[model samples]
Target: MTTYDYLIIGHGIAGATLAHELRRRGRTVLVLDTYQTDSASNVAAGLMNPVAGKRFALAWRADDFLTAAATFYRELEQRFGQQFFFETPILKLFSSVAEQNTLLARSADHPWQNFVEELAPSLPPAPGVRQDFGGVRIRRGGYLAVRELLVALAAEGLEQGWLRRETFDWNQLVVGPASASYAGDVHARRVVCCEGAAAVHNPYFDWLPLTPNQGEVIDVECSGLADTQVLNKGAYVLPLGAARFRVGATYRWPPFAEGTTEEARAELSQRLASMTDQPFVVLAQRAGVRPAVRDRKPLLGVHPATPVMSILNGFGSKGVMLAPLLAGHFADVLEGHAELWPEVNILRYHALYVAARKEGGFSS
Candidate 1:
């Protein structure tokens, strides 16, 4: 049996970053996971856009999160010897006059004005990208090489003997007051579950309001499109160098089956057409479920009754932007150095667990 300070379940963005933070703090860790092609982290485009939605409302704590994320990825680059994060301007194209007016109104303000560079009606923002609507150049925007980073992290973990490529059986997880034991061969002081959408089936944390959505992205090879910037209106086109781009995505809710579908392919093809009429070839299509939440917040904290088991999930599409900083914050809380932020802490939903217990319809 090998006992560690922590056992992290999942190698997605959240688990990888958290494990790295803990190990950097000199804690021994073992990551238990098997690669899944359709997992969000594997198929993610890793887009980071602060100027979001039709109303141009900024993402929550956008400034703080953006700064921290940049620093974090740069630090990862130093540690991993690869460039994972790329900083580039995003060209936000306007679809209609009303949308353009809203952008103008926002740009007229002090901070909003500082974040954008005026563009003359989408005048060929990038090669092969549309030029009809004129767009605003957003300063704080970029993409993380999500899939590549995970592969690298997995390789590193495997080389270091801290990552086991296998499926985790729930029946084998035993939680104690001060520690956890798994599969008869692993013991840890605490177990942190970062299992993405799979948490819906977790007996210990299923009370959470996790709203998983099916998202799809398509890869294409366009000879003319440049890799210097990202383009967004209804959908996004992220350049992957060598004239390749990843275009996406379509969000599907419940009653939807998992995996890639023809409908999504057509829908994305149409959206890509709307972005440009340039020549391109579809290289591949991917489908994954994003672990979203009703309140659009990341879930963090330990099980109420089972103190040795905790979770960090529901990051949805913002995992790249939110995980790095939040992992550090949560690490601080786990180490008793700081209190968990009220907005994202799982303690807010303890009442739901209590209510479920009273109803006698829940799992451990």
Candidate 2:
């Protein structure tokens, strides 16, 4: 019969960040989660790239988010005695002259130019590599050890009696105007749902346009590839220390299935084989649903109809880079210190949902 100020469901990146923030603010927080079943955080390559690999466009709010996320992880490491963040560069191999030109144009006027290093001319491509332009170096880009960080957070929550190891049953929830009660004993002033793609099943906030995608990846052990930097030619190859690399990511829509298939393994092996002729051993493969949106921004803020509920999911592929800053913003809203960002707030979805409902559009 323990009551808390905040109850978080899920222990993925978003939920872990929220719990960390609330506990840091001296609030009693509870987390209910069932971890390690193709959880997006566990399967994530944890790569943070400043420039999108396809179009070379700068990531959303790269400057603000990058600095804040780095500081957040560093501070967390110092506080918890665990190293969660690594500062490594991303070497993006250019495909065509047109792409190289676009990169040049962006480098001149882009705000994140300082983080981009010119490396197209001198660095020769490795054997069996071919490209129109050499490549560009992304400064201060790296991966977060998401699994380790979650373990540390869960340990902290356990020490404080704020973590429950079980799946949450929706039928046990009793909502009120100012508070929420879960399973009769767990009472909280508010509840924030960070259940990744599962948020679409939430009764109050399900109407938002959540375009979830299934991404599959392969884990391989390659002997010679350096473990310092994330390499990008066509598919990304993230070095996971000690000759282990994670290669992956095929994006598919709707028909959501969280199991890796033989076809996926073949596709990923094809791409990895194309990257290098080096012998690699396929160790494992996994697939998980990323909580993406049509507009490619995070979905954050309070529920429109139910004042006691809120959500902090929909980080999509950039959960590590996006969650730390957005979690602080959510904390600000809960503390009544600031308003939520309009571009990312769920209220915009509510507005659109209302309009669509009036126009006879299908809404939840």
Candidate 3:
């Protein structure tokens, strides 16, 4: 039996990146995942923005995340011999005068100045884009071919003999004070759960504030649309080719339904229409659940009672930007070289874990 140094569950962005970092450090690792179709990482458009939302507020640690992501993804592309990261400016078309003012205030003279380019005379008419109110072009933004990256990572992991393509069976998992094992055969010194949105159902860590949000995106073929930049309104139009674009992302909360919905399709089409009157044809639609947290920060750290178990999830839609830096931090913590950042550390939710345990959610 191989006693791996670390066992990782789920091969989504969080797991793959962390595994890559660990392996780079010469650690023996094993990763188990089925790579489910509904996994958010597969469907996500992989948009990375420095300043977002109606308020045009800067993201937390925006500079650090973008810098790390640029370096990390480029490294992965070179190592895997494939291109997955696309660097381009995101043109944010304003919807209202208030939003235009917000952009000016955020970019004119703020720490966010470097990440934004305020439009001159604002709202210049593009070939096929509609910008009623002025907009701003964000400099530190891009897209990642998320599914392709995973495929490349999977191939690399297989060739390296560290990956198993199978669903993890918790029923067969046994954890001790210092280690964890699966089916009484697979063994590792520590287990890190990177199970994406499914972590909400994980009995060991369900006590934490891991909220799931379902998002949907559609691929379309619209001729004549500019292919150099990503256009944004309420939704975004990401250019994939000369005549191909990926528009998406309808947010559905609560029930967190599986698969796609007709309502989502209509909503997406309407969003596209709002941005442009282009007569594009929908090629495909994909939906996945994001492992988001109520606090809008990631979840990381070891379990309260079981030091053998740890979690690295809750990235939500910002997975592309957040995964790189956070993974490096946790990997450093794992190697005893550093500690987990307080804001993202799962220990902050230890009280909730204990409360849920007392309420009979799971045995300690």
Off by over 4 Å in 2: 121-132, 355-364
What overall lDDT goes with each candidate model?
0.87, 0.82, 0.88
lDDT of 2 by residue, 249-345 (tens): 8887988565988888888888777666678899999988889988888888887667788889889999999999999999999889999999998
> What's the number of clashes in each of the models?
3, 0, 0
For 176-199, candidate 3 gives per-residue lDDT tens digits of: 888888987788999999999999
Model 1 per-residue lDDT tens digits across residues 247-325: 9888999868778999998888888787776888999999998999888999999788888888999999999999989
Highest lDDT scorer: 3
Report the candidate with higher lDDT, 1 versus 2.
1
Rank ordering of all candidates by TM-score, starting from the highest: 3, 1, 2
Residue pairs in steric clash, candidate 3?
Answer: none
Candidate 2 structure, TM-score to reference: 0.92
- The true-versus-predicted C-alpha distance at residue 46 of model 1, in Å, is 0.6
Best by TM-score: 3
Model 2 worst lDDT window (10 residues): 121-130
Model 3 residue 215 lDDT score:
94
Worst 10 contiguous positions by lDDT, candidate 3: 117-126
Listing every candidate in turn, what is its Cα RMSD in Å to the true structure after a full C-alpha superposition?
Answer: 1.6, 2.6, 1.4
